[model samples]
Target: MQFRSIAMAIGMTALIGATLLAPVTAAEDVPPAPLPSQSLAPLVEKTAPSVVNIFAQKVIRNRSATRYLDGSAFWRLFRDTLLFGYGQDRFESSLGSGVIVAANGVVVTNYHVIEAASGILVALPGGQVYSARVLVSDQRTDLAVLQIEAGGAALPSIAFGDSDRLKAGDRVIAIGNPFGLGQTVTSGIVSATARTSFGVGDFRFFIQTDAAINPGNSGGALIAMDGTLVGINTAIFSTSGGSQGLGFAIPSNMARVMVDGAVKGQTLVRPWIGLSSRTVVPQIAELLGLSSLHGVLVTDVFKGGPADSAGLQPGDVILAIDEFPVDDPQALRYRIATRAAGSTVQLTLERDGEFHKIAVSLQLPPNEPARNESWMPNLSPLRGARVASLSPAFADEIGADSGISGVVVLEVRIGAGAYRLGLREGDIIRDIDGRPVRTVDDLLTFRTTPFKSSRITLERAGSVLTATRN
Candidate 1:
C-alpha cells in the first residue's frame, strides 16, 4: 500500500510538469509579432481614397481652311465662307489629380487643371464619379477650389500638415494619376524648401521634391509619412516630358489659405506690403555689412505704403517676417500675400548694421487709378475698346509697374476693328495723332474730331508699337 501511494505521487508530479511546459512550447512555436509591419501600406490605404482623378473637357473652335495653303483672292473668299461650314467645335480634354480637403466634398487642385473647362468630372476610387464645379480660382497662385455634389455621401478627406516646418531630406510620398495610368504612388525626399524662380506659374514659391511628378500628377497630393498633406504637386522639370527627379509643389499653407478663402465666398485676395526689393547677393551683403547673403535689399518703397508707414527705409534689408527667415524678396512677398488684409505682420529689418522688428498691416493694392471704359463710335479701331486710367491701384491690379502712368487699353472686343489693328489690352496709348493721350478723357476728346486716318503710338508690355489706320 505504501508503494502504491509513492507511485501515485510520481504520476501527479509528471502531469503537473507536462501541463506547465505545454504552454511554453506553444508560445515558442507562435512565431514573432510580425516585425511591427514597417511598410507604409496602412498610411497609403488610409490616404489614397482622398486623392481623386479629374477630367475636364472644353469645346475648341478650329478652322479647316487654314489647312489648305492656296491663298487666291477668289479661293480666299470661298474658303472664308466655307470656313463657317467646315469649322467644327472640337472637344478638348485634360486630365489631372486633386485632393479632397473637406468631408463635404471640397477639393483643391491646380488652376490650370480646370481652367476654361466647360465640364469637370471627379472620379473617386471604387468607380464613383461626380461632377465638379469650380468655386474659386486664383490665377496669381495657380490654385482652384472645386466643389463636388456628394449626394449626401461623406467623402474621405486628407488633413493639411504644416509645410513651413518641412525640412530638406524629409521623406515624402506623392499620389496621383500619372499619364492616366490610374492611381500611382511615388516616394522621394524633400529636395529643397522655399524653391523659387522656376517659372512654373504665377506664384514662383514652391517646395522642391525628387518625387516623380508627371503630367497627370498636377494637383495631386504630396503627403508626409503620417498621411498629412504637405504640398500639391504642380509641375515637373523634364525635357522629355517625363519625371527627371525634379518636381515642384505649391505649399500646403498657401493652399489652405486659398481653400478657406474660397469656401467663404471670398476667393483669394492677396495682400501685399506695397514695395519692391531685390535679393541681397553675396557682394551686396558685404557692402551692406551683413553676415551672410540672406535678406532682401529694399530698392524702392512706395510712399505712404505699408513698408514706409512701418518705418521701413529704402536702404533697409528685410531679414525675416514674423521670425521666419527671409532668404529672398520672393519669400517675403509670399509670406505677406498669404496673410489676410488688415492682419498685422512683424517684419525684421536691418539698417546700418542694426536689426529692428517692425509691424506692418497688410493692405489691398490701392485702386486709385480710375478705370474708365470708353467707346468712340466715330473712331473705327478705337470703337468698343475699353480704356482705364493708370494709377498705382490699377497698375497693381493688372500686374503692371506702379511707376507707369497713362491710359491703358483694358480690353478690345473680339473681331472688332481694334482687334484687327492689334490694339490689344495692356497697350498704353501714349499719343493719338500726335495728341498726348494721358487719360481716357484725352483719348475720347481726341477721337471727337474726325480724320480720314489716325496714328496711335502705344506701349505694349514695355515695347513701343505704333499703328496707323487709314
Candidate 2:
C-alpha cells in the first residue's frame, strides 16, 4: 500500500540494491563517463518550475493509535509524540506532495493525500505556499486534482506527454520532497514498462524508473527529457527503509482521463463482467483442447453476477475486451476499470471449443468504500471466515466495532473447515478457540496449541454466534 516503517524501508532498499546500475570505469576503460544525464540541464530548467510540492492537512476520523501496551522503544517515541504529544497533545496530521499542471495553478496529487482534508496548500519553488481547493478526486487511480487561485499572477506549468509512446531506457527526472527535503530532484533511466503491482491499485500500468523516490515524493512529477510530464510519481518498489532506486509512476494517459473527468465534475464509470481469471499454462491449454495459451482462462464466475446473467461461464477463454486484446488478466481489469461504470462490455470469449461474442452490463462493486474505495481483502476463510491484517481500514466493513480483532480471511477455499460450516465472506470472527482473537498470530497459535473443534464466535451485523469445525 502506501509504504511506511523503517524496517520495511530497509528491507525494500536491500532488495533493490542488487539491481542498481553498474559503476562507471575510470581512466582508459572509457573516454569519459557519460554526463550524469544526457542533456539534463535543459529538461530540468523547463519542468522543475512547474513541479510543486503539495501540503495537505486533514483529520482522520477513526485512526488507530501507533502504540500498544508493549511500550517498546518505538512505542515510547510514538507515545511521546502521537498519543500524549509528549504532554501538550496534538491532533492527527498527514503530509504528501503534488505538481502544477496549469498556469492558473491547477495541481494534481494522490487522492489519499487529501482524503478528509480540511486544508490544502501548494508550495512553489520560492517557498510561497498558496491555498488550494480540491476540485475532485478519483479513488480508482489514486489521483486527485486541486486548484490554487492564481488570479492574475503567472504560475509555472508543465504539459502532459503521450505516455503511450514511452519506452524503456528513456531518461527521466523526479522532483519532490523526499523525507521532507524540500524541492529535491533525482534522475535515472526507466527501469521497466507496463509493470503491474496490484498493491498500488486493482487495475495497473506503471512507468518504472530507478530514480531515488521516497515518502514525500508522492504526487510529484515524473518528467521526460523533452520537459513533458510523462507520469505522476506515485509508489516505490522497495524492501529496505530507503530508496534503492526502484520507483513507479502513474502514466500520464491514465491520469489525463481522470483529470478531464474531474474538471468536468463527472465520475468515471467502470464496466464489470464478474469473473476471476488465471493465466493459462501448457497443461491447461491442452486440457482445454486449445492450440495456445495466450488468452485469460476464466476460473471462477460469481453466481448471479453480471457474467452469469449474460451467460458467461467458467472455462471461457477471454480473447479481447472491446478493441484492446485481453493478453493478460490485468489487461482485462484495466480495460474495465477505465470504462464508465454501468456500461455494457463487448467481450470475446471462447467456450465449448467455439469462439463468440457476448455483451455484459456492468454493475457497481456491491461493497464500494465510503469514498468509493476499491476492493477490500476477502474474509472468506477456513477458520470461521477471515479478515485481513494488512490495513485497519477494513475493520468496520465486516461488522467489527472499535475493539474487534482477528486475522481476516483473504480467501476461502471451498470445502475447507470454515466453508463447510456455512460461514461466508464478510464474517468477522471475534473469538477463536474460546480465546478473544485479535490478530493472525493469535489464530495461528491456536491452530497448533492443542486446539480442536474451535468454538468460533463472529459478528455478522448485530448478531453473534458460535460455529464448530472438528
Candidate 3:
C-alpha cells in the first residue's frame, strides 16, 4: 500500500513538470522584463565636482598650566627655563566636507565643523585649495556659509532641490569625505522624514536615512537621483562611533535659508508664531474627535502675535501649512521658520470639527520692553552673570517660554560666584527673597540689597527650582 501511494505522488509531479516544460507558441511568448539600470556614475560625474573637502585648525593656549604655576615661583621658573613651553600651546585640527552652492565660490557646510577654528581651507577637485572664510554660522541649524575666491573662474555648483517632496523609500546618494578618505558616495533610501526625536540641534527636524555616514561626513551633500542637493549630512546614530546605516541630515530647505542670509549679508532670524503647542497624542485625538493623530494642538496663543491676529485660539489643531501636513510641533516650527519674515503662509487648522484655512503673515518676535542688560556687582551672589529683561524676542532667542515675563540670565562667567552657585544661562529669575522680579532693574535692586540666607526661585526650560545662598 505504501509503495502504491508513493508511485501516485511521483506520477502527479511528473505530469506537472511535463506541462511546465511544454514549448510555447509565438503568441504566448512575452517579452522579458528589462533589467534595472544599476550604475549611478552619471549622477556622480555631475555632482562630485560641487563637493569639497574642508580642513579646519584651532590653536589652543594652555592657560590652565600658567594659572596653576602662578603660586609656585620655583615651578614657574623651572618650567620657563627647562620645559621651554612644552605645556603652553598646542594645535587641534579636524576634517569635514562642504558643498559649493554658488558658482562664485559660496560654500555651505555644518557650523560645528569649523566652529572656533582659527583657520579653514577648502580643497576642491583637481588639487586646487583655497582659504575659506565664514560668511555666517548658525548653531541652531548647524549650518554655515563660507566664501572662497575663485579668481574669475566659474566653479561647479549644485542647486538646491525641494526636500518637501522627498518621501520614504526614495533613493538618495551621500557624497562626503568619510573617514578622511577622498570623496566617497553611499546610496540608500530615506528611512523617514520629519524625524524630531534626536537631540542634534535646537531644531530637531531631520531627514533620517540608512546611508553609510561616518566621521568626516558632516556638511557633505545628500543628493537625490536628479542630481540636486536634498540634505546636508550632519549626524549618525551609532554605538561604535561609525556608520550603522542610520544617518541624519539637515534638509536643503533649511540650508537654503542659511545660504540666502549669508549671501545677502543678513543675520539669520527665524520667523515666529506666538503659540505654545504640544503633539496630538492618541488620547487627545480621541477626545477632540480627530480622525488621526496628525498635527499640533495649540495650548495658548500670545496676544498681538501672528496667530492671534489670524484669530487662532487654543484647542485648535494645526493640520498643515500651505498644504504640507505637519505631524508635530517640531514640524510646524520647522515649516514656519524656513520661510522669510515678511512672507505670508496659509495655515490649515481644525476647529469645532471643521477645517479652516487662514492666512497668517510671518514676522520676527517683538522686542518689547527693551533689554537693559546689566552685569551684577562683583561682591554679589549673582556676580559675573549678565542679566537682561525678558521680552518676546529675547525669550525666543534663548529658547524660553515666550509668554513668560521676568529677568533672564544671558551669560554666566566661569569660576565666578554665579557659576559656583549653579546659576546658568537661560534661567529666568522669577523671585528673589519672596519679591517678584519683573525686570533687570528689579534684579539689580535685589543684587544690591544685603540679605542673609536668601532664597531665589528660578524657572529653567519648564521646571521651577529654588536656590539658596547663605
Candidate 4:
C-alpha cells in the first residue's frame, strides 16, 4: 500500500508539471499584463544628494583617573593630583546621518547626534566636508537644525511631503549611513502610523516602518516614492543592535516645525491646550454611550486656559481636532502641537450623548506665578542643585504634573550633595524635614536653618521618594 501511494503521488506531480508547461491555446483569450517600473533608480538619484553623513566629537573631562569612582573618599583624594594627570580631557566621537532641507545650507538631524559636541562636520557626497553649527536643538522633539557654509552656493535639498497623508502599506525608502557605511538605501512599506509608547522622545507619536534603519540612520531621510521627505529615521527596536524590521521616524510635519523655528531664529515652543486626557477604553466607551472606542476622555482642564476658555469641561470626550480623528491622547497632543500658536482650531467633542463643535485658540503655556529660580548654597542638603517654584508653564516645559505645587529641580551638579543623595533634575522637592516646600524661597530658607537628621521628601516621575542623611 505504501509503494502504491508513493507511485500515485509521483504520477500526480508529473501530471501537474506537464499541464503547467503546456502552452496556452487561442481559446484561453488571456492578454499580457503591464509591469511596474521595476526600479527606484530615478527616486534615489533625485533624493540621495540631500542625505549627508554627520560626525560629532564631544570632550570628556575627568578630575582623576578613577573618576568612575565618583563620590568616594579615595577619588576625592586622588582627584586633581598631578601624579596621574587625571585632569586631562579626552575626545569622544560619534557618527550619524542628516538631511538637507534648504538650498541655503540648512540641515536637519537628530538632537542626540550632536548633543554636547564641541565640533561637528557634515560630509556631502564626493568627499566634500563642511563645518556645521547648530542653529537650534529641541530636546522634546529630538530634532536639531544646523547651518553649514556652502560658499553661498545652493545645495541639493529634498522637498517635504505631507506625512499626514501617509498610510500603512505605503512604499518608502530610507537613505542613511548605516553602521558607518556611507550612503545606503533600503526600501520597505510603512508598517504602521501614529505609533506611540516607544519612549523615544517627549512627543510619543511616531511613524513606524520596516525599513532597515540601523545605527547611524538617525536623522536620515525617509523618502516617499515621489522623492519627497516624509519622515526622519530616528530609532530602531532590536535585540542585537541591528535592524529587526522595527524602526520609528519623526514625521516630516513635526520636522517642518523645527525647521521653521530655525529659519525664524526662534525657539520651538509647542502650543498647549492646558488639559490632561486619557484614551477611551471599551469600558469608558460603554459608560459614555459611545458607538465605538474612539477619542480621548478629558481628565482635567486648567482654569482660565485655552480649554477652559473654550468651554471644555472635565468628562468631555474629544473626538477630533480640525476634523482629524484623534483616537488617543498622544495623537491629540501631536495634532495640537504641530499647529502654530495663536491659530484657532475647531474641535469636535461629545457631551451628554450629543456632538458639538468648538473653536479653541492655541497658545503657549502661560508662565504665571514666576519661576523664581534659586541655586542651593554649599551648606544645604541640595547643594549644587537649581530649584525653581513650580508653575503651570514651567511644569509643562519640564513634563511635570501642573496640578502639583512644589519646588522642582532644574539641574543637578555632579559630585554635589544632591547628586550624592540621588536627587536629579525634574524631582519636585515636596518637603524638607516635613516642612512643605511650595516655593523657591521655602527651599532657600533651609540653607541657613539648622535641622537634625536631615530627611528629604521628593516626587520624581509621579512617584514619592524619601531620602535621608542621618
Write candidate 3's Cα lDDT for 1-470 as tens digits: 99999999999999999999998678648777899989999999999999999999998877756577663667766667798856656899989999999999999999999999999999997689999999999787888999987686888999999999999999999999999989999999999999999989777899999989999999999999999999999999999999998999999999998889889999767787878677899999999998778888887687889889999999999999999888876788789878999899999999988999999998888897789999998867899999999877877676676655678998999999888878999899889888988788887776534555788898876567898887
Candidate 2: tens digits of C-alpha lDDT, residues 1-470: 44568779988898788667556567796576666755677777878888777777765432233333444566557756776644222346566788887787778898877877888878888777788898877665778888897675889888888876788998889988888777888999899876865368545678899998998899999998888898998888779867887898988877776776667777543344566676678898999997678788886565566778998777899888874567666666666655665788889878878889998887754432122222222342354344454122343233222223344454555666667875666565667667876555555455523444557787654356677766
Q: Which should have the higher lDDT, number 1 or number 4?
A: 4
lDDT (Cα) of model 3? 0.88
What order do you get sorting by TM-score, best first? 3, 4, 1, 2
lDDT of 4 by residue, 234-328 (tens): 99999999999999999999999889988999976778787878789999888878867889888768778888999999889999999989987
- Worst lDDT run of 10 residues, candidate 4, spans 79-88
Query: Candidate 3 — which residues are off by over 4 angstroms?
Result: 1-36, 65-81, 282-292, 375-386, 401-404, 411-424, 429-438, 442-459, 462-470
RMSD after Cα superposition, model 4: 9.3
| lDDT by candidate, in order shown | 0.83, 0.70, 0.88, 0.87
- TM-score for every candidate vs. truth? 0.75, 0.60, 0.81, 0.77
**Clash statistics: count for each candidate:** 1, 20, 0, 0
Which prediction has the highest TM-score against the true structure?
3
Ranked candidates (lDDT, high to low): 3, 4, 1, 2
Relative to the unseen true structure, what is the C-alpha lDDT of residue 55 in candidate 4, on a scale of 0 to 100?
97
lDDT, candidate 2, equals 0.70
